[model samples]
Target chain A: MAEISFPLPDLGEGLIEATVLDWLVSPGDQVERNQPLVELETSKSALELPSPQAGKVIRIHGAPGETINVGEPLVVFEVPDNTAGIVGTVPKDDAPKRRVRLSAVLDED
Target chain B: MSESTTALLEAGARDEQSVKLSMQQALNRALDEILSTDPKTVVFGEDCGQLGGVFRITDGLQAKHGESRVFDTPLAESGILGMSVGLAMAGFHPIPEVQFDGFAYPAINQIVCQIARMNYRSRGTLPMPITLRVPSFGGIRAPEHHGESLEALFAHVPGLKVVSPSDPHDAYHLLKYAASRPDPVIFMEPKSRYWQKGDVDTSDAGPLTGARIVRPGRHLTLVAWGAMVARCLQVAELAAEDGIDVEVLDLRWLKPIDAEALATSVGKTRRAVVVHEAPLTSGLGAEVAQLITQSCFDTLKAPVERVTGFDVPYPSGDLEDEYIPNIDRILLGIQRVLEYRRG
Candidate 1:
């Protein structure tokens, strides 16, 4: 299982923190990308935060009414490892690679 | 001739000629002229240098002034604004574009805390003369976070001069004036009307800190700014046909509003209506209404009315025409105010 982490979005002209209004999704619930995850209030207006990944929410860092800062992790998701071969592994330089012909010719000629 | 007389003569000759140009083109010309005339003036923002900005307001400026003077910045709004504050403190006139009204949120902290306080914090020893140009308003059918009317937020902040231009002429002259001022300015350009052509007489352009009366009427005064000024003009024409004389006043400088013009118009008309594209609750109209009532209480024949957007996140593009105050709403507001007979 791969862990998906949610970061606080930049709000209010370089503002660092925003008060959490309410959470729409709870731990263990499945969420899709761009789905409303939480409601937040800034000095200017109230905003809804969207989920960044499609997965089950494993954990929430803060409760309702708590202020969250930008770039701070807000939620964790368990995503399926679809590209297991590429996950956390470096490509081997010695592996056989395919070569492509720059020009094509007719065999009859 | 004396120096003042010579200057006046030169200005008079310049004012007589009218030039027709779109709002964005006029803004580009103003930047070109200012950058050419002042060595200390600099323009920097996202995609502003080589790309000439998203709307091309800064087009051709990079080639004319070079990259050092007119250059593109990273996609960080906060960094752009904070850097402009430092440049201003160092005695350079920095005009940073926030790209859009919604994107300006990332620079609010730097603007409110740093740029706004630098002058007062330094006790006038260090002056921050940064001009932040933001293209604002709706009706362009842009995506989310593109069209927002947040002028009230900047106007509420101290040490910041918030100005919005209604047309090409105001856009050109106000930008030049903002560059010359010794304080941070939030210069809001009407995004939707950027291509609307208008006649601009570079000579007749006035100072940046005053208001202009666009239409003269005797019944009621309608105060507005930015693109709403143009809408108010249309409303005035319609009202005239309806037999209601309405005066349209454009508050060019939102922060240091023209109290003289406001007072005079309201005193004469005795009835007033404040209109804007922003929401009704706590918008700039609130402040304008308070000021009018406080200053022209005895002269007011009716309570000031406000026609503005609802207190909700700007709706989808399809509903924007209904969401924003339009000519019909203005006419309704005029009718409401005219019907108010003090018992």
Candidate 2:
């Protein structure tokens, strides 16, 4: 068995916290990778956060209406080793930084 | 003097003195300078090629730098943004223009999911350094949806840095800085003030992340950005007549906000009011209020009041005055915060 800790996914605009609107899963429930875990709301809009790994629900960070900050663990899971490897290794930063070069000729006046 | 000599003297005078340029011209200058300085920089957006953008901010750029560095794209915001991400990933600095604030909605999916999440999803392996230029706000009597303040929406997205310039000088320099930064930046230009004049002294400007104390005061601190900074300054001037000293803070960088600068002013003033044209509920004020409460809780003299647009879709052009926050609303909020008496 492997322990699964899911950090709060970025809700957008570099927001740090989100209000827990609703929870789709309960403790001891089986879940799959990328499964909807909970619904959260920010100043912008309501968003559904997905599970990063397939596992059995072990714990939740807060109840509905509670505000959780980004980077804080939102859910805990118990999963098989293969599932745990994919879930726990998810990247924290979502902004792509790869650099490429391009050339476009402009029309003159 | 002879006619030729007179003409030559006038030309010399024009060259000797700085030309009074509109906000769009300032933007052109900045883009032109950056592209000339760095061969890696390139620009693309709708009508940006020969037409020089709808607002003409990109005018003369295609001619000066040649299409190799500056060009136009099809009328597709998502396509523009997606291509920018692809170009940035390949190592080029692509500055895509979203013609108007209203037109940017179609690209929200790409911006929030692809551009913003790319860097974090790739574990820092892929950095989206593209700059999205969104000219927003009202006062120019534009049609519906054209004058929207969606900064809060962009600010809430992680991995995206949101920046707005209240004047021309910052517009020029900030765009340059955004081009150079490693993170993706959403640059919101205030449409109403595009023609408003301000001095652009390149030597004194600082980095893109810092905030500016446009007006220094002690009674209360007014935090604003974009065009609202101009409003705050106006309000501060009026507040002076009523013996209210209001410190105005222009939060140039909305995301990764200048917490220290904000705390310092709020700490001194012991009162605060946030102003913006976006809807009041869950606006940027919510984040700022939380930050002030957590960091400057002990310095509190009053609750942090937010003077923002009503929680409604941006209204028709005629009813915009009611939907957007104005001097009267901001002044009223300031009065409420100042007059509050603890029981």
TM-score of chain B only, all predictions? 0.94, 0.92
lDDT of 2 by residue, B31-58 (tens): 8888899888889898787656766678
Per-residue lDDT for A3-22 in model 1, tens only? 54567867758688888889
**What is the per-residue lDDT of model 1 for residues B1-343, given as tens digits with 9 covering 90 to 100?**
8999999998778767678887877999999998999899999999888656777688779978999999999999999998998888788999899888899998889999999998899899889888899988776766677768989999999999999999888888889988888888899998777777788988777655688888998888999998788788877876766667789999988998878888989988888999999999999999999889988998787799999999988876767878888777778887778777669
The lDDT for every candidate, in the order shown, is 0.82, 0.80
Candidate 1 deviant stretches above 4 angstroms = A1-109, B1-16
Top candidate on TM-score is 1
